[model samples]
Target: MGSTSARTETCKSTSEREIAALFDRWNQSLQTGDPRKVVANYADRSVLLPTVSNTPRLDAAQKLDYFQHFLENKPFGRIDSRTIEIGCTSAVDAGLYTFTFARTGAVVKARYTYTYKWDGSQWLITSHHSSAMPEK
Candidate 1:
Protein backbone atom coordinates (compact mmCIF):
# COMPACT_ATOMS: atom_id res chain seq x y z
CA MET A 1 0.00 0.00 0.00
CA GLY A 2 1.11 3.53 -0.72
CA SER A 3 1.17 6.49 1.59
CA THR A 4 -1.86 8.75 2.01
CA SER A 5 -2.79 11.66 4.21
CA ALA A 6 -6.30 12.25 5.55
CA ARG A 7 -7.80 15.67 6.21
CA THR A 8 -8.11 16.55 9.86
CA GLU A 9 -11.54 18.16 9.65
CA THR A 10 -14.47 16.21 11.02
CA CYS A 11 -17.53 15.34 9.03
CA LYS A 12 -20.70 17.37 9.46
CA SER A 13 -23.32 15.05 7.97
CA THR A 14 -21.83 11.53 7.85
CA SER A 15 -21.83 9.23 10.81
CA GLU A 16 -19.39 6.53 11.90
CA ARG A 17 -22.00 3.86 11.35
CA GLU A 18 -22.58 5.04 7.80
CA ILE A 19 -18.87 4.78 7.08
CA ALA A 20 -18.83 1.28 8.52
CA ALA A 21 -21.77 0.40 6.32
CA LEU A 22 -19.83 1.56 3.30
CA PHE A 23 -17.20 -1.04 4.14
CA ASP A 24 -19.93 -3.62 4.49
CA ARG A 25 -21.32 -2.76 1.08
CA TRP A 26 -17.89 -3.09 -0.47
CA ASN A 27 -17.42 -6.46 1.16
CA GLN A 28 -20.75 -7.57 -0.25
CA SER A 29 -19.70 -6.48 -3.71
CA LEU A 30 -16.65 -8.73 -3.46
CA GLN A 31 -18.89 -11.68 -2.60
CA THR A 32 -20.77 -11.23 -5.86
CA GLY A 33 -17.68 -12.53 -7.69
CA ASP A 34 -18.13 -9.94 -10.42
CA PRO A 35 -15.33 -7.55 -11.22
CA ARG A 36 -17.76 -5.01 -12.55
CA LYS A 37 -19.83 -5.12 -9.39
CA VAL A 38 -16.71 -4.73 -7.27
CA VAL A 39 -15.53 -1.85 -9.41
CA ALA A 40 -18.93 -0.17 -9.18
CA ASN A 41 -18.23 0.77 -5.59
CA TYR A 42 -15.28 2.85 -6.79
CA ALA A 43 -15.23 6.16 -8.58
CA ASP A 44 -13.99 6.35 -12.18
CA ARG A 45 -10.69 7.84 -11.04
CA SER A 46 -10.20 5.71 -7.98
CA VAL A 47 -7.00 3.97 -6.95
CA LEU A 48 -6.77 0.37 -5.84
CA LEU A 49 -3.71 -1.02 -4.07
CA PRO A 50 -4.78 -4.60 -3.92
CA THR A 51 -3.83 -7.25 -1.41
CA VAL A 52 -2.47 -9.81 -3.85
CA SER A 53 -1.30 -7.61 -6.66
CA ASN A 54 1.69 -5.31 -6.66
CA THR A 55 0.38 -3.04 -9.38
CA PRO A 56 -1.44 0.11 -8.33
CA ARG A 57 -4.68 0.36 -10.26
CA LEU A 58 -5.50 3.98 -11.06
CA ASP A 59 -8.54 3.79 -13.30
CA ALA A 60 -11.65 1.71 -13.87
CA ALA A 61 -10.12 -0.49 -16.54
CA GLN A 62 -7.06 -1.20 -14.48
CA LYS A 63 -9.22 -2.06 -11.51
CA LEU A 64 -11.25 -4.36 -13.64
CA ASP A 65 -8.08 -6.02 -14.84
CA TYR A 66 -7.01 -6.74 -11.30
CA PHE A 67 -10.41 -7.92 -10.17
CA GLN A 68 -10.90 -10.10 -13.20
CA HIS A 69 -8.15 -12.36 -11.98
CA PHE A 70 -8.93 -11.92 -8.30
CA LEU A 71 -12.58 -12.89 -8.65
CA GLU A 72 -11.47 -16.23 -9.95
CA ASN A 73 -10.16 -17.01 -6.50
CA LYS A 74 -13.58 -16.41 -4.92
CA PRO A 75 -12.46 -14.11 -2.14
CA PHE A 76 -14.50 -13.17 0.90
CA GLY A 77 -13.27 -10.65 3.47
CA ARG A 78 -14.11 -10.11 7.13
CA ILE A 79 -12.96 -7.15 9.15
CA ASP A 80 -11.12 -7.75 12.37
CA SER A 81 -10.42 -4.17 13.50
CA ARG A 82 -11.12 -0.74 12.10
CA THR A 83 -10.60 2.99 12.60
CA ILE A 84 -12.80 5.52 10.86
CA GLU A 85 -12.13 9.15 10.12
CA ILE A 86 -14.68 11.38 8.46
CA GLY A 87 -14.24 14.70 6.76
CA CYS A 88 -16.93 16.90 5.24
CA THR A 89 -16.94 15.19 1.84
CA SER A 90 -14.35 12.47 2.37
CA ALA A 91 -13.78 9.68 4.82
CA VAL A 92 -11.19 6.98 5.59
CA ASP A 93 -11.65 3.49 6.94
CA ALA A 94 -8.43 1.76 7.95
CA GLY A 95 -8.30 -1.68 9.41
CA LEU A 96 -7.08 -5.22 9.64
CA TYR A 97 -9.07 -7.93 7.90
CA THR A 98 -8.96 -11.53 6.77
CA PHE A 99 -9.88 -13.07 3.44
CA THR A 100 -10.88 -16.62 2.73
CA PHE A 101 -10.47 -17.96 -0.77
CA ALA A 102 -13.05 -20.55 -1.57
CA ARG A 103 -11.16 -21.98 -4.51
CA THR A 104 -8.11 -22.88 -2.48
CA GLY A 105 -9.51 -22.92 1.03
CA ALA A 106 -6.82 -20.45 2.06
CA VAL A 107 -7.09 -17.69 4.64
CA VAL A 108 -5.04 -14.53 4.52
CA LYS A 109 -4.86 -11.78 7.08
CA ALA A 110 -4.44 -8.28 5.69
CA ARG A 111 -4.40 -4.57 6.40
CA TYR A 112 -6.61 -2.23 4.43
CA THR A 113 -7.60 1.38 4.15
CA TYR A 114 -10.42 2.63 1.98
CA THR A 115 -10.94 6.31 1.28
CA TYR A 116 -14.32 7.50 0.13
CA LYS A 117 -15.90 10.65 -1.19
CA TRP A 118 -19.54 11.69 -1.03
CA ASP A 119 -20.09 12.47 -4.68
CA GLY A 120 -23.36 14.34 -4.50
CA SER A 121 -25.61 11.26 -4.56
CA GLN A 122 -23.62 8.49 -2.95
CA TRP A 123 -20.38 7.59 -1.25
CA LEU A 124 -17.82 6.24 -3.66
CA ILE A 125 -14.43 4.80 -2.95
CA THR A 126 -11.68 7.12 -4.14
CA SER A 127 -8.78 5.00 -2.98
CA HIS A 128 -8.40 1.53 -1.55
CA HIS A 129 -5.11 0.22 -0.21
CA SER A 130 -4.71 -3.35 0.94
CA SER A 131 -1.74 -5.60 1.67
CA ALA A 132 -1.26 -8.95 3.26
CA MET A 133 -0.10 -9.01 6.85
CA PRO A 134 3.71 -8.75 6.84
CA GLU A 135 4.34 -11.56 9.28
CA LYS A 136 2.24 -14.01 7.32
Candidate 2:
Protein backbone atom coordinates (compact mmCIF):
# COMPACT_ATOMS: atom_id res chain seq x y z
CA MET A 1 0.00 0.00 0.00
CA GLY A 2 1.25 3.49 -0.91
CA SER A 3 0.09 6.91 0.34
CA THR A 4 0.20 9.96 -1.95
CA SER A 5 -0.01 13.57 -0.98
CA ALA A 6 -1.31 16.36 -3.16
CA ARG A 7 0.00 19.91 -3.13
CA THR A 8 -2.22 22.91 -3.52
CA GLU A 9 -0.96 26.25 -4.61
CA THR A 10 -2.79 29.54 -4.51
CA CYS A 11 -2.09 32.31 -6.97
CA LYS A 12 -2.72 36.00 -6.48
CA SER A 13 -3.85 37.97 -9.46
CA THR A 14 -4.06 41.73 -10.04
CA SER A 15 -5.93 43.27 -12.94
CA GLU A 16 -4.61 45.89 -15.33
CA ARG A 17 -7.14 48.40 -14.09
CA GLU A 18 -6.14 47.76 -10.50
CA ILE A 19 -2.50 48.27 -11.39
CA ALA A 20 -3.34 51.44 -13.27
CA ALA A 21 -5.17 52.79 -10.25
CA LEU A 22 -2.00 52.45 -8.26
CA PHE A 23 -0.71 55.46 -10.14
CA ASP A 24 -3.69 57.44 -9.00
CA ARG A 25 -2.90 56.49 -5.45
CA TRP A 26 0.62 57.74 -5.89
CA ASN A 27 -0.45 60.90 -7.65
CA GLN A 28 -2.88 61.71 -4.90
CA SER A 29 -0.10 61.29 -2.42
CA LEU A 30 1.85 63.96 -4.27
CA GLN A 31 -1.08 66.33 -4.05
CA THR A 32 -0.73 66.23 -0.29
CA GLY A 33 2.42 68.31 -0.52
CA ASP A 34 3.94 66.16 2.15
CA PRO A 35 7.09 64.31 1.19
CA ARG A 36 6.42 61.66 3.76
CA LYS A 37 3.07 60.91 2.24
CA VAL A 38 4.67 60.47 -1.17
CA VAL A 39 7.46 58.38 0.29
CA ALA A 40 4.93 56.11 1.92
CA ASN A 41 4.09 54.75 -1.54
CA TYR A 42 7.59 53.37 -1.93
CA ALA A 43 9.23 50.33 -0.46
CA ASP A 44 12.07 50.68 1.96
CA ARG A 45 14.42 49.18 -0.57
CA SER A 46 13.52 51.30 -3.54
CA VAL A 47 15.12 53.58 -6.06
CA LEU A 48 13.87 56.85 -7.48
CA LEU A 49 15.34 58.32 -10.63
CA PRO A 50 13.49 61.59 -10.68
CA THR A 51 12.76 63.94 -13.57
CA VAL A 52 14.21 67.20 -12.31
CA SER A 53 17.36 66.01 -10.64
CA ASN A 54 20.42 64.06 -11.68
CA THR A 55 20.79 62.36 -8.31
CA PRO A 56 19.59 58.79 -7.93
CA ARG A 57 17.56 58.44 -4.73
CA LEU A 58 18.32 55.04 -3.26
CA ASP A 59 17.05 55.26 0.32
CA ALA A 60 14.22 56.78 2.29
CA ALA A 61 16.14 59.78 3.45
CA GLN A 62 17.35 60.55 -0.05
CA LYS A 63 13.90 60.14 -1.47
CA LEU A 64 12.51 62.33 1.26
CA ASP A 65 15.03 65.00 0.42
CA TYR A 66 14.16 64.98 -3.23
CA PHE A 67 10.45 65.03 -2.64
CA GLN A 68 10.75 67.81 -0.12
CA HIS A 69 12.00 70.09 -2.83
CA PHE A 70 9.86 68.66 -5.55
CA LEU A 71 6.61 68.83 -3.62
CA GLU A 72 7.12 72.53 -3.26
CA ASN A 73 6.18 72.85 -6.91
CA LYS A 74 2.68 71.49 -6.13
CA PRO A 75 2.93 69.07 -8.99
CA PHE A 76 -0.15 67.39 -10.34
CA GLY A 77 0.33 64.49 -12.73
CA ARG A 78 -1.80 63.05 -15.49
CA ILE A 79 -1.01 59.99 -17.53
CA ASP A 80 -0.85 60.63 -21.22
CA SER A 81 -0.46 57.01 -22.29
CA ARG A 82 0.58 53.84 -20.52
CA THR A 83 1.24 50.14 -20.81
CA ILE A 84 0.80 47.80 -17.89
CA GLU A 85 2.47 44.42 -17.47
CA ILE A 86 1.56 42.06 -14.68
CA GLY A 87 3.78 39.42 -13.14
CA CYS A 88 3.66 37.13 -10.14
CA THR A 89 3.82 39.39 -7.08
CA SER A 90 5.07 42.19 -9.29
CA ALA A 91 3.88 44.57 -11.98
CA VAL A 92 5.23 47.31 -14.23
CA ASP A 93 3.44 50.44 -15.43
CA ALA A 94 5.30 52.57 -17.89
CA GLY A 95 4.13 55.46 -19.97
CA LEU A 96 4.13 59.13 -20.77
CA TYR A 97 2.85 61.60 -18.20
CA THR A 98 2.50 65.32 -17.90
CA PHE A 99 2.98 67.25 -14.70
CA THR A 100 1.64 70.71 -14.16
CA PHE A 101 3.19 72.72 -11.38
CA ALA A 102 0.56 74.82 -9.73
CA ARG A 103 3.05 77.17 -8.21
CA THR A 104 4.74 78.21 -11.43
CA GLY A 105 2.22 77.12 -14.06
CA ALA A 106 5.00 75.01 -15.52
CA VAL A 107 4.23 71.85 -17.45
CA VAL A 108 6.57 68.97 -17.92
CA LYS A 109 5.97 66.06 -20.26
CA ALA A 110 7.94 63.05 -19.26
CA ARG A 111 8.42 59.38 -19.93
CA TYR A 112 8.05 57.35 -16.75
CA THR A 113 8.22 53.79 -15.50
CA TYR A 114 7.05 52.48 -12.17
CA THR A 115 7.90 48.96 -11.06
CA TYR A 116 5.85 47.71 -8.14
CA LYS A 117 5.98 44.68 -5.92
CA TRP A 118 3.42 43.09 -3.67
CA ASP A 119 4.93 43.25 -0.20
CA GLY A 120 2.53 40.67 1.26
CA SER A 121 0.17 43.49 2.22
CA GLN A 122 0.22 46.19 -0.45
CA TRP A 123 1.83 47.14 -3.71
CA LEU A 124 4.80 49.42 -3.21
CA ILE A 125 6.91 51.15 -5.76
CA THR A 126 10.16 49.25 -6.12
CA SER A 127 11.70 51.49 -8.70
CA HIS A 128 10.51 54.73 -10.27
CA HIS A 129 12.20 56.41 -13.18
CA SER A 130 11.12 59.59 -14.93
CA SER A 131 12.80 61.75 -17.53
CA ALA A 132 11.63 64.80 -19.40
CA MET A 133 11.01 64.52 -23.12
CA PRO A 134 14.22 65.60 -24.82
CA GLU A 135 12.76 66.97 -28.03
CA LYS A 136 11.26 69.96 -26.29
* Cα lDDT tens digits for candidate 2, 1-136: 7998887434458899999999999999999899999999999999999999999999999999999999998999999999999988899999999999999999999999999998888999999999999997
Instruction: Quantify all predictions' global Cα lDDT against the true fold.
Output: 0.91, 0.95
* TM-score (C-alpha, index-matched) for candidate 1: 0.89
Best by lDDT: 2
Superposition error at 34 for model 2 (Å): 0.8
User: In model 1, which regions exceed 4 Å deviation?
Assistant: 1-12
Tens-digit lDDT track of model 1 for 8-45: 65444989999999988988998898899999999988
RMSD of 2: 3.5
User: Cα lDDT for residue 33, model 1?
Assistant: 85
Model 2 accuracy (lDDT, Cα): 0.95
Off by more than 4 A, model 2: 1-10
